[model samples]
Each structure stands twice: as structure tokens, then as C-alpha cells.
Target: MSTSMAENATKKLTLKSGDDELFEVEETVALQSQTIKHMIDEQWLGDVIPLPNVTGKILSKVIEYCRRHAGAGAGSGDASTSKSEDELVLATTTSGDDLKAFDADFVKVDRCTLFDLILAAHYLNIRTLMDLTFQTAADMMKKLTVEEVRTMFNIENDFTKEEEEKIQQEHPSAFK
Candidate 1:
């Protein structure tokens, strides 16, 4: 490769997940996470950025989200300049619809994966990912019984009978 070509190449960062999986992500993409941005700013440019709280599967999904949004300038406010006029027009017209569809398909995972995504998003401090995962979880809980919600999340009922009765009385519509 030419010297200028190599010089202009996007810099990459290696992220190590809890499961010992390493992912190569562009600096622009990884900087979407405030936690990662701070780490980089503080000279945390070691061999690999250790993400001890994120599993390989969830980290992969998070990287996928970051790559998509980074490419589209979702959080950074810098759109791509390489698109043709027709392509740009198409993206302008359908970007929102396309993103909505992508998000809907992205969150259609099992409960465990959903929770893993929520935890990973929170840890990474990626607001868009956090909001999307939280809203998805909330949508899953809508109109469900308390028992069903607990069962779905594998959460044991820790409230005493009195406490449960008081809560039910306070939020009668929720119970009903």
C-alpha cells in the first residue's frame, strides 16, 4: 500500500470481552461510548480495552450497534460524505424508518440476551443503546401481571404479604 493510503486508514481499537473474545472496532465507532471515550482520553491505549462486565455475545451486538450508528452519524452529528446524490436523497427520506426497523429487529432476542444488552449498555455509558434496551424491556412488561413479570425475569417475590397488599392497594390499576 502507498504511504498516504496507510496514513489515512481508520485507526482500530481492540476490545476484550469478559469471555476472552477480542473485537477489532474503529476508533470512531468505539468512541460512541462515553466510558470508552474517557478511557481513551486518559491514555488507556493499552493492548486491549478490557470489558469485564460484557459477555462476548452482548459485546458483539453492542459493537454492531456502534458501527451502524457511527457510520450513520447518529450520536456524533457527522454524516458520511461519500454517498452519491441519489443515495443521499434515499437515506434522507428513509433513515428514520430504516433505523426503527433495525432497532425492532435488534431487540427481538430472548430475555437473557435482552438483560445482557441492558447491562452492557449501562456499563458502556452509551445513552442511545441504554434507552433502546430499556424501552424494549419496558415494552415487554407492558400489560403483564406482576407474577408474570417476575417469572419472566426469574425474580423471586421478596415482598411480604403485607407489603404486597399495600402496593396493590396503592396501585390498584397495576394489579388489575
Candidate 2:
């Protein structure tokens, strides 16, 4: 087989999540994460790459996202990959409506799980995943009042009544 053929072949990497769960994924899928790619490059990685910051559930979701994306771009060999997450997300959202739909459904988890996926994606340096999760969070909070947003995130109301009133007065539209 040719070198390109060999490179395209399904190579597997084992990942060990923080909760001790193990996953075997294609190298193409795992390489979607710069963190995992760097781990593979910077060390004589053993059989398993350990992700100490991510739990199994989050890791599983990350892998699913990576697998879907890698499969989407397979064989196309498009060299116009974006450098920044903001640009990449914008570019991707315009180009692939199917992927956009997938991303919309993918982020429909409960708040805690969505936040966990965001942290895991950030840690993994998967910019697309990070952007998707962040956008989902922003979408969830966009139409909500400050109090409703606080309640959604379980954040305490730290400001005094007078301070709150001052803020409401200053930004009446935000309060409404």
C-alpha cells in the first residue's frame, strides 16, 4: 500500500478518562483534538493517553463529536482549515448545514453536562466543539433575565438590593 493509503487507514488510540474508563478511537478522530495530538507527539505515549481533567461521560461525548467531524471531512482533504475557533465556527456553520444540525442536537444536554462538555472541549483544544458548546450556552442565556440566568446557572445574587436597583436603572432593557 502507498503512504497515503497507510495514513488513511484506521489507526486506533486508547484514551483513559479521569474516571478510569477507556475508549479506543480512530487516530483521525482523536487527532481532531490538539491536546491529544500533542500528547502523541511530545511523549512516548503508552497504550493509553490519560486525560486527567475529563470524566468518562464527557470524553465519550467529545469522541462522538470528533468522530462525526472527522468522518465528515474525510477524503475531501480541504486545506482551508481556519486558524481560530471563532473563524472556524463561522466557516463551518455556513458550509455544512448537516453539521450545524448535528451540533444543535449534540448540545441539547442538561446544563451540567453541557458545561462539562464545554470544559472538556476546551481542555482538549477542540475549537469547534468549544465554539458549539459556548454558542449553545449563549443561546440558552440570551433571552433570559439576569435573575433567570442566575437561577439557571445556580449563581448567587451577590449584589445588594440598592446595587441591583442601580444596575436595573442603568440598564433597564437588561432587567426587562
Candidate 3:
């Protein structure tokens, strides 16, 4: 097909990586990102826009988040007005039990995937997702002991015994 025709015909995109892995996403969803929008505007993307920084797995998950939010008209700059997230919460207040269940389940993800979701949400500029992910992370920090936190993330304790004790004293509530 001619280049102009190809450009016009493309409403979806296949983002490929150097390893030849591909991710399929809608133009509207992909364009939630300013980076992707610029690529579309400049017609720099062919059938497959290469995203070498993103692995196929992470990109796939990101695409899932983007697609869902996009379909709900949650992304930025659409002509149609969206209910503010607070307004959405208010409207759903009558169904409080259901919302609580959904929120609980939404955060039930592996630690690595939780961080991945946080990064993806931030990159796509999805505020609700980021807030949820960050809150989950903070909850983990609050609940886990210092040793437990170190074990969970495989982080080494750098402090000497005396230093560790001093820190514990300084932040007495952290250990409790």
C-alpha cells in the first residue's frame, strides 16, 4: 500500500522490540503517552514501532492497563468529558461493599508486578493506577519489619550492629 494510505489505515499499532517481540495496542490507547503521540504525528512509526526499552511482558501488561483506561475514556485530552475519579467514587458510594472488594482484589499482585504496574501507570500518566500502586507499596512498608522488608526485596542491611541499634532507637515506631 502507499505510505499515506498505510498511515491513514493504521488505527492500531504493533510495537516490536529488538528481539522481534510484538505488542498490539489501539492508537488512542497508545497515544495516551506524549512520546507515542509525537511518533504518530510525525508518522515515524511504521506498522511496528520499536520499543527496545520495554520487554514484551512488561509492554503487554502496560498495554492492558492502557486499553482498559482508554476504553473507559480515562486518558487525557479526549473531547468527551469524564467523571472525575472522586466523582466516580462518590457515584459508586451506594455500592460501597463492591468498591471495597474491587480495590482489594486490584492490589493483589506479586511484588515485582506491583512495581511494574506503578511504573506503567506513571509512564502512561494514569493517576488512579499510580495512586493505588503507591498506596499498596506504602502499605507493604508499613506492615513489614525492617528485616522482613529487607527479605522481601532481597536488600542487604548496610549498617553495623551499633548503627542498626541507633537507627532502631531513632525510629522507634518503625520496628514496632
Better of 1 and 2 by TM-score: 2
The Cα error of candidate 1 at residue 52, in Å, is 1.2
The clash count of every prediction, one per candidate, is: 0, 0, 0
User: TM per model?
Assistant: 0.80, 0.82, 0.66
> How well is each residue in 78-168 modelled by candidate 2, as lDDT tens digits?
4223122332343455447787788888998998999999899999999999889999889888889988998987899999999999999
Lowest-sum lDDT 10-residue window in model 1: 75-84
Alpha-carbon deviation at 16 in model 1, angstroms: 0.7
- The residue-level lDDT of candidate 2 at 82 comes to 17
Q: What is the lDDT of residue 71 in candidate 1?
A: 51
- Superposition error at 137 for model 1 (Å): 0.8
Which residue pairs does candidate 3 place in steric collision? none
Give candidate 3's TM-score: 0.66
Estimate, for each residue in 111-170, the C-alpha lDDT of model 3 and write its tens digit.
988887777667656666677789999998898888898998899998999998998899
Residue 48, candidate 2: Cα error in Å is 0.5
RMSD of each: 4.4, 6.0, 7.0
| Candidate 3 Cα RMSD (Å) | 7.0
**Which residue segments of model 3 deviate by more than 4 Å?**
1-10, 17-19, 41-43, 74-78, 81-106, 121-128
